[model samples]
Target chain A: MTAGTEMSGPRGTLPREVPSASQDSVPLLEAKGLNVWFGRHRRQALRDVSFRLAPGQRLGLIGQSGSGKSVTALAVMGLLPDTARTTGSIRFEGRELLGAPERALAALRGRDIAMVFQEPMTALDPTMRVGRQAAEAVRLHASATSRATRRRVIEAFAEVELPDPERVADAFPHELSGGQRQRVLLATALLNRPRLILCDEPTTALDVTVQAHVLDLLDRSLAASGAACLFISHDLAVVARVCQDIMVVFDGAIVETGPVARLLANPSHPYTRGLIAAARLDEAAPGSRLPTVEDFLRGTGS
Target chain B: MTAVFTVDHVSQVFQPRRSALAVVALDDVSLTVGKAERWGIVGESGSGKTTLLRLLAGLERPTSGAIAFEGAELTPAGRDSQRGFQDRGLRSRVQLVFQDPRSSLDPRMTVGAIVAEPLRGRRRRAGASSLSRPDRAARTAEVLAAVGLSADAARRYPHELSGGQRQRVAIARALAPNPDILLADEPVSALDVSVRAQILNLLTDLVAQMGLTLVLVSHDLGVVRHLCDRVAVLQHGRIVETGPTEQIYARPRQPYTQELLAAVPRLPAVLPPSDERKPPRPLQK
Candidate 1:
């Protein structure tokens, strides 16, 4: 065992409070040999990346932009633009998704899988009431009466802990603050009762206090529903706070993956170490100089 | 006596409509910025740090209070401060360096023209009817060198230079008028972490060398701890905690202040023979 990494128990679903978590068995969702490219120039957005989304696994996908984190999620959901070309084997409980028809993919989305994006304004309709939008997502996946739909919407809103569902439902996108809008976006994603969620920088646009609240709401919902999530963020501190396991993505490839405690404690890959080192510098030590990019490069080199 | 400016009892309330709720941006916020004070205002979004800086700059009027620059009221008593604000002498006394330098600087204008803008204004303010073309070029070159930029940057657009270089040009423009104080709102927050230190150091050096008073609006407490002697922790339009930076960090009174301090990342200890690491809070499963 690596030094000081003995507390890292086997990759299994242990009790809560362990902080150390990983998957020893098969995952709920698995992607194998994924590839994505855009434009006639064949710009590769993702390059042969693979990871699993196991039940109760709060996995963080950390990387800078163009590092292939977002593109991988988009490809899984069949939401990539027509300009993009893809080749990958995505399996959800032994089912292949790469070649799955558009209709099948649509059925899977919101019902089996849902995504919360960075900007809620883009995910939500500006003109439509937030409640109706959420209701429509629920109705699209499950057959329900108007009253039942209203109940589900209220439940979803309550799940995300929105203060007042009725007022928020009646309110337009502009009426809610940045934090409220993000909660509504999460509520919309949950309306379909998806088993797994793809959170792509959902809290990046929010304030720190509000981001804490949003993250708490997510963890609470995940705990209750047994829904695993792939949480992506550029900040490793936030990732350490939220994720059980982390997959360090860089240059369109996942260079390292391990339990959160193990990865943060001793990152093996150079890129992973660079991220951890960069994140560690944020510690407010007095009188000491913060590490520069050159230091980060040197650490990565080592 | 090296203090360049002081903001005292500043309070601003926006009353857009008769029935609309009045928003108090700052309340009795007072601070004395020393010659080399790299003061930072930190808080969550809507914490009124930006509003306080504006009041200091005479950009907006405090519903009640005063801003004194070397004992001269920024909001002059008899005439509109707006009149003095436009006066090249008063305007150049305190300058603002905005957050997004790319947008703050005119894209069409080259670096030389942007830096030279204030110099020409100063000349015109001094009743210089005209200047020889050679003289204008010489003045621009002098200011550019002082800001540590090469003459070649004179020809490049704001987009041509990196973020740090663009900020340097902005600093050069502000320095052109030779302001005694510079107010920067969340400067370098948009830049990558690596670039942030360079900008912070530049502001520190500028203050020490040029004797500039810097009132920085930022959410970074670590930067504030290193730069400022004292800090006022604002919460919900109120100054919850104000004290020496060392004291505030050592013994945070307000829970919000404590929370903000706690949030600043701690360098993860590369654990020695021991295994377990203690975090501030345990992860809730």
Candidate 2:
């Protein structure tokens, strides 16, 4: 894509023609006033969270750890822990998903909604061959023969640009480098051809160079498969690179929501402003004090 | 300027318990860190950045090549001594801050005890002339305050404090020795986005205030550029490129270094003019 060319805009100016989700289309996934409380004390985890994802659209959920971003994704998947209680509505393809049956959610998980987690090692089974794991993902969602499943797994690995797909498939997770392991996870996520991909800091554990490769692969794959993605990350630059829309969540709620270009051009929330200021370390003078979230919060008296 | 550390053609090799093949972690790597100068060692995982930091911290001796601390060769300690460096002076002069405070800081110990642990080593070496109990308490309080933690924080445990506060405690412990050099291994990599700036700012201030020679190892070039004047790029355990941070960032000599720089996702160079920006308001539920 010509997205790389758009980055050369005199540094401070927003990228030209930033993609925004089509508002007129029927929403693929929609959440309304989502609230989550955990355990016996009913401690609130999420508060009045609401957003919409159009078909084939990319939405970035920006927040730090424990900011309810991950919880929102888990809530959509109906994968929240048993002790947690959720209210409000989550609809996927015009079907209510919040209180869906376990069997029904299981069937929809890998077939329609696939998730890629931050840490590949923990997410993947250490004892299983990486190829077999990919095959298992395919086997669960589809009724393909064993040989066909193996071929599909190999094809998925090749599609994710893993070199020597056969060799990588046979190797254990411990043998592969961090980038290679993350690719295996990505290949597994894409093997089912899910319509929606939920990436929760998929490249957070990777090196910058490896992260670039993975993000590029994801961007290309999403474009090719016409799959929508909900990319969650604490890094605004990374989220901005892959996602068209930005949602800034603070504490348990979203503080701002807008197109990526608009958000970067003029952030309206103090927390969002602080995040942008902190992330622009390239522009910060050497040895100068960086503006923190507290500085922004205090300056605005919020 | 005097060199705080001189790593001469260092090479580190590790052999697994039963494996015939040996892994060369660092191959003929050499660098010099001047006193009070911040140097960043950038590399991917398994590129020997942490291994080099460990070598510099005197946690492990290199398989080959000599390391001189302040012009004095650091030799292995005697069997009777538990420290890595034979010289007591060198042992107390260099301190290390690890990546994750959750695992690095002992969960069993209170914040006060953890920060004061290094001082006890000094006390042991000083014998009768060591600091008194009250003096040690005062020193602990002072370091904690310097790291932006209150004195009351000393009474808490690692789990009781936030991730940022735990890191502050780790920095306070590293500073308790009043060392001339600070070796940080991905110090802020595990922190939240909002908290990273605070820690970086704190490190910058403390390094300047204490005149510390810092060796920061990280994969984040932006962080390295913000903190280090000079940078050494390590690839496959070798020094691929080394120069001023700005020089390397602007015109990298190696293709690998250029690719590494390009891969970093960058925010816009500057935000729009303030007049175009809107004042922020509190989000209503």
Candidate 3:
């Protein structure tokens, strides 16, 4: 139990660096009534999704596949495909992002905001060296000399606890292990000193032990930099472990949103309750049937 | 009390292309599974857990050492080729359910054909009992229902089903042959949180009803504890610890096992007050 509690805590407990400006006024990121439609069918992928993350605050989006968590992230980053029509208000640092010019959004991206994808291999260029990639991110915003960029890249690597930072900097994505590659990807994401990091199941592909370590790394980085995060994942435990606040997404809608401890302890929505019950592997007895979401949906008419 | 399967000093080495160094996937590992026992192998990536499972399924032979089934040595030579478990009788007796059914299940094949293909292989084997088309179809429907899939699922392709249902189809395929031992590698890891529990429960029920010896490999300790009677912690091609599930979780002897257990994410133990009152701030340093 001691070990378990050590991995979990509510928000504002860490030694977080105070935000530069007043965070009480404008949130770091905010989305309102986000509705997304894909292709000619214009089928609803996300509907009326809304949330807010204050500067230095970590917000988790929890949902299963096709729940529009990733789509939400893409919508925020202004990276959604052309065919996908979106109707929503996305504000980053009090600036309207939805329907904003791509050039304007691109200027904020990698400078004020960045994203870490689930699969690091595909996110990274296999042909490019890890350090060069990190350096490139740094160079995108700042007019740094090549030498200064390399030094900053190595510093970012060290920040993420990558061992033998020099050696890791020289290696390619394929040359590194999954954990190492993830760290490199994280380094790239954080290299530009972005105000917010949109992590879409970043640690899902990693092993449990490695996942813990990476989660720790992310916590420390977030605290040190005072950057906000929109952590997205399907695992309830993982989302609860990482973020202070949680939002449960289902069928392209936000079902529940609250402080992590409160929501997990007494989930109001049947879907949230079902998700919590499903993840309770420890409490489940041997040979007993595990309660499924379908059971809740049937009982409560989801 | 009889030993259902025994792995004797198994060691597997793979030589990477253009590299002189050999990757020791499994090194001098030995284990024995008694009848009706549900055993779990837990480890992180590169821990040889999957290699051990493959070896148990007879899908791959060790470069050195031997595996015995029902007290008889399973020779990797005459009856098998590169991918082991070629003996149809042995294949039927020790079936493997993979981590991802999307990749394992053939996309073009209907669910019925995928499940019945194993029995079809068994029929081709000399001295094996052959079943009629209708009997095979009935057996397929039976196993599908056992795994909680409807009879209509047989007519659909793998792509038509959800991830959890695809895994159920995979499980049905594994059970179609009536295997004495069921080896599942991270069966529920690929599934959503809501679907995972259902799948685990299904596996637990089926294993008990069929009286099948079970070998599960997963990185999640909680799932292992929920399903397995005994547990083994593997790291870098070695069994770091092995004991009963309760005892191991209650009092882990190995430091690695302790660390692995600690790494599993648990829900925070705080319950917020009913009102929307803010939590008291911690005292500043």
Q: Identify the leading candidate in terms of DockQ.
A: 3
Error of 3 at B18 (Å): 1.7
DockQ of 2: 0.36
List where candidate 2 sits over 4 angstroms from the true fold.
A1-24, A300-302, B76-86, B122-129, B269-285
Candidate 2 C-alpha error for residue B96, in Å? 0.9
lDDT of 2 by residue, A1-302 (tens): 48776555334322223233643344778899999999999988899999988777788999877888999999999899999999999988767787767776887887789999999999999999999999988888678998999999999999999999999999999999999999999889888889899999999888788999999899888878878899999999888778777899988898899877789888898889888887887788878898888888788522
B1-285: candidate 2 lDDT, tens digit per residue = 558899999999999989999989999999999988899999888899999999897777888897778786664434322353633556667889998999999999999999999887653433334677898899999999999999999999999988889999999999997888999999998887788999999999999999999999999888899999999999989999999999998899999888888888887454433333111211111
Reference-based TM-score of each model: 0.80, 0.90, 0.90
Select the stronger candidate by DockQ from 1 and 3. Answer: 3
Per residue, candidate 1 scores C-alpha lDDT tens digits across A120-214 of: 88878999999999898888777799898988888888778888888898899988988899999888887776888899988876656677778
Ranking by TM-score: 3, 2, 1
Looking at model 1, residue A72 earns an lDDT score of 80
lDDT of 3 by residue, B51-129 (tens): 9988776667789988887777775556554233444467777888999889999999999999999888733434657
Model 2: clashing residue pairs? Answer: none
What digit string (tens of lDDT, one per residue) describes model 3 on residues A133-196? 8888888778899998999889999999999999999999999999999999888899878889
Better of 1 and 2 by lDDT: 2
Q: Arrange candidates by lDDT, descending.
A: 2, 3, 1
Assign candidate 2 its CAPRI class: acceptable
Q: For residues B1-285, write the lDDT of model 1, one tens digit per residue.
A: 735667777787888685577887887777777776666677877889889888777787778877776676778657687776666466666788887787899999999889878766533444434445677678778777876689888999998888778888888888776677788887765554445655665666677778766787766676677666678888866788887888887899999988887765443465322234222122333
